[model samples]
Target: MKKTRNTQKQDYVIDILTNAKHTMSVEAILKAMPIKVNKTTVYRILERFAEKGKVHFVTGEDGKAYYALCNDCNVKHEMHNHIHFQCKSCKKVTCLPYEIEVPELKDFEVQETQFLMIGICDMCIS
Candidate 1:
């Protein structure tokens, strides 16, 4: 696989996501960027990251897409079966460490699975 050159903006975006340690929306990512970057550019960067298996996205409870860095994904395969937790109070989305077993089906092949748990987080509970 050909590795694409990352621009300054792309590096900045990756930094934001890496430091965040949680899922963030496009608007949030734009706000976190120190330099001025257009929305289209951010979207394109995220698309490239997804293609390279560096990042993954999930739809939040609010119907907005949230992005986060991939833990064990690569260009050949992108498999995510871990749990994603969303706090109802804070509306924060985070990738949980626990991985659930994907059940086998007799006549079907499951390509992807997303397990989302909606509840209050530790901060909110305290």
Candidate 2:
């Protein structure tokens, strides 16, 4: 497979995700960017990054898709295999270190698993 070079927009998006404290929606990412970028362009870049395994999205408690950079994700293997936790109060989504293995069924194949836990975050509890 031929590797495609990342465009300027893609790089910028990756940088934003890398530095973000928590998962961000497309609109949030756009607003946080220093320079202006088209909404469509940002979405496209995110989609491409997701396909390449550089980033992944989780549905937050707000019913919005939140994108996050995979800690050690690369072109070859992009799966971080971590649990996603969304705070019920603040609606902040965080990646947890707990890894859960999916049970294989006799006649079914499990391609991927998206695990999520919704609860009050540490800050919210205090």
Candidate 3:
């Protein structure tokens, strides 16, 4: 058996995602990174990770994309039907533990689903 090597950029992105407490935008990710990287490169890496089920993202009402790790997904299956909570006050996005089963569509295959709630979070309320 052989293992694939992760690029330095990918490793850095993974480290950032793993340590992040809330979903982060591309700008936020770039600011948190130790070294500056091209915006396109960062987005590309994030897109790859999302496709691989390593990370997931939700677009904010403001039209910015926020990303978080998919703790339940694996290489064989991509578990991404988890709920997302976005704090209205702080504008922070958090991945909720709640997972829901998607209902089937007639003559159609569902590839992805997004269940997001926007409101004041506990931290914001306090």
Candidate 4:
């Protein structure tokens, strides 16, 4: 298998997501980037990553998308059966480690599921 090389901007974006403590929005990613990258470029990279199963995104309560690196995903299959929590006070999104069982639907196909819980995080409570 030939592993394609990543561009400078792509490398930067991956590094930022890899080191992030929680999921980040596109705007937040752009702000954290050291080099100048346009919005379209960031969106493109993130989309590609998601397609390749390297990253995943969740829609927050504010209707904004937040991205985070995938822990156990691959190009063949991407499974995210966990909860996504957003801190209302800090406005940070995190992929909780807990897993939830998806109920079987009769004569219906379930492709994906997202469970978003909005509340004040521990940091804000302290």
Those runs of model 2 whose alpha carbons end farther than 4 Å from true positions after fitting are 1-6, 73-80
Give candidate 1's TM-score. Answer: 0.84
**Candidate lDDT (C-alpha), each:** 0.84, 0.79, 0.83, 0.86
Worst 10 residues of 2 by lDDT: 72-81
lDDT of 4 by residue, 23-100 (tens): 999999999999888998999999999888888888999999999988665223355778899998999999888887
What candidate 3 gets wrong by more than 4 Å, as runs, is 1-6, 74-79
lDDT of 4 at 33: 92
Rate residue 101 of model 2 by lDDT: 58
**What is candidate 1's lDDT per residue for 23-97, written digit by digit as tens?**
999999999999888999999999999887788887889998899988555323355767889999999999888
Better of 3 and 4 by lDDT: 4
Q: Looking at model 1, which ten-residue stretch has the lowest summed lDDT?
A: 71-80
Give model 2's clash tally: 0
Error of 1 at 8 (Å): 1.1
lDDT by residue for model 2 (5-101), tens:
4466677788899999988899999998777888888888988878777888887767788898877543233334678999889888887778765
Question: Which order, best to worst by lDDT?
Answer: 4, 1, 3, 2
In candidate 1, clashing pairs total 0
What residue pairs clash in candidate 4, if any at all?
A: none
